[model samples]
Target: MPVTARHLIIQGRVQGVFYRNWAVALARDLSLSGWVRNRRDASVEMWVEGAAEAIEQFIAQAHEGPPAARVLRVIAQPVETEGFVGFEKRPTA
Candidate 1:
């Protein structure tokens, strides 16, 4: 079932890393649309909307981000698609 979801990834060593860039690449590859950004609480936040299988792949990749991030947990929730066109880094919001 094509769906939209928001994810909050608690990464132990994600800051100052290339996690965002890696995520952008991955999301683009998966053809998913939405945004990714760094949170003030030192976590990475993502919103994605696309095919179920692609979103699944995104979740799997997010767990092991950039080979430099120590992903501790990935908290996900449902969200509205909002018809995003592409993946990008959102200015901290």
Candidate 2:
């Protein structure tokens, strides 16, 4: 299957809610490769790449993050894929 890559920005009540950890867990489970991190604007950002179906599932789930996350919106943009071995949690940017 071809890889579908995306850059996503999640907004609203995403911080302090273990959003990054949630993302990593799900992405890995979906056999995805990417990195998720927190932004200074109190939002969260991530770049994911994998099977098209996996990407779709990842984005769909991102709209409703961890139990504590109140994801108001998820902005997904198609982007060129990068070299990522596995899902990771990056320091806040």
Candidate 3:
């Protein structure tokens, strides 16, 4: 499987709703490496690295985050690398 990375900006009702924790669990379930953090702009930012298919799955699931979250938009961009060992929840940015 080809490995790839993506930087995703998930906006709208993504903070304080267990979004970060949900992301970590989802990434781990997919056997991916990356980090998810909250932005000052009230959006969630994630950098994920793993099999191309897994990354795509992660993005798709992120669009429908935890029940409390109301995901408005998901902006995903190709990234070179995130240098992560395992999925983690990062400090708010």
Q: Give each model's whole-structure lDDT.
A: 0.81, 0.95, 0.94
Q: What is candidate 2's lDDT per residue for 1-93, written digit by digit as tens? A: 787799999999999999999999999999999999999999999999999899999999999999999999999999998878999999989
Candidate 2: regions farther than 4 A off:
none
Tell me how candidate 1 scores on lDDT: 0.81
TM-score of each: 0.89, 0.97, 0.96
Per-residue C-alpha lDDT of model 3 across residues 7-89, encoded as one tens digit per residue: 99999999999999999999999999989999999999999999999998999999999999999999999999757899888
Error of 2 at 8 (Å): 0.2
> Least accurate stretch of 10 residues (summed lDDT) in model 2?
79-88
lDDT of predicted model 3: 0.94
Task: Tell me the number of clashing residue pairs for each predicted model.
Answer: 0, 0, 0
On lDDT, the leading prediction is: 2
**Which residue segments of model 1 deviate by more than 4 Å?**
1-3
Between prediction 1 and prediction 2, the one with superior TM-score is 2
What local lDDT score does residue 70 receive in model 1, on the 0 to 100 scale?
A: 89
> Clashing residue pairs, candidate 1?
none
**Model 2: colliding residue pairs:** none
The regions of model 3 sitting more than 4 angstroms off are: none
Give the better candidate number (1 or 2) by lDDT: 2
